[model samples]
Target: MSCSEDPTCQELLDHIYELVDADEDAIDERSRALLAAHAAVCPSCRDAVDAERHVRELLRRCCGESVHAPAALRVRVVSMTTRVRRTE
Candidate 1:
């Protein structure tokens, strides 16, 4: 599909966080395809997604196989996310 027909940059960006938060195989096929199409044409979105994926991989490697944060950290992260979302 052409870039014009693909999801917009913001749409792809919204999915990138979800993509980064989950295993690739766990994401819905449509979202994966949308993100892939957007990333193929938009260098900035591609770089952003790539960076997010890189960070996720690095965290997985460093945190070991299970790859989960502590409860306190999760709480703080969620609180921060909520605050950011509220502002947005």
Candidate 2:
């Protein structure tokens, strides 16, 4: 599906992160095109991209490395995974 067809915010956010983090020259043509297309029209997602970039820069300046995900998020992910697995 085209990027426009991807209705989920998480997909757009993931694409934005990939665009910011991946080497442009190393990315495949299709992926690059998809990111470009998505960023062109999605202002909210673009703001998210900008925010992520700013955070990364701040982390680099202050901590010299990216911060780890919060413990709460990790715990939530583990709990969700266990719940899903038990239902299977």
Candidate 3:
């Protein structure tokens, strides 16, 4: 989190969210590689990058993949499930 007065430091902070998200649509591999290379030489950037990844990892572990709906809710939705045909 010590951004250490580098011009590129702000660049890293700006794109940190897109970088950590790991979505290609959000950030291309080349841009990510450039940022990573910058972080490699800069201790400050490296620490910030690592911390962001760590926080996201912790959230994934704590929340898990998916939650099951309540049994009653599931049953009610199933009962109400229906399809309507459209007339042209």
Candidate 4:
């Protein structure tokens, strides 16, 4: 029921977040290589990694896009910063 019983699976579980990153810098090169090699040979882990990648892509599509602050909020923030600077 869980990967906790197997060291290899545990390793994949531990690094799942890093494995799902779109950028290579999220994980060390050596650790990424080791996990990728492991996933290549392990179907369960490979599927798990694929699932995570899919989820990350979905989230990126849904919530990761950049946005401009609303005009009212931007004005409020600018006002706050101006007051703070004057007080300093």
The number of the candidate with the highest TM-score is 3
Which is superior by lDDT, 1 or 2?
Answer: 1
Model 4 alpha-carbon miss at residue 47, Å = 0.6
Q: Please give the ranking of all candidate structures by TM-score, highest first, separated by commas.
A: 3, 4, 1, 2
Please, what are the lDDT tens digits per residue for candidate 2 over residues 1-88? 3446443456656565466667666566577566666766787666566655665565567666756546475346445554654588
Give the C-alpha miss distance for residue 19 in model 4, angstroms: 1.6
Query: What is candidate 1's lDDT per residue for 2-40, written digit by digit as tens?
Result: 346577878776677666665566667776777787788
lDDT of 3 by residue, 1-88 (tens): 2334433878887787677776689877877777777888998777677766655554467666444445475335333331111121
The backbone clash count of each candidate, in order, is 0, 0, 0, 0
Task: Give the local distance difference test score of model 3.
Answer: 0.63
Query: What's each prediction's TM-score?
Result: 0.57, 0.53, 0.60, 0.58
Off by over 4 Å in 4: 1-7, 22-26, 66-88
C-alpha displacement of 37 in model 2, angstroms?
2.0
Return the clash pairs for model 3, or none.
Answer: none
User: Worst ten-residue run, lDDT, model 2?
Assistant: 1-10
Q: Report lDDT per candidate.
A: 0.67, 0.59, 0.63, 0.64
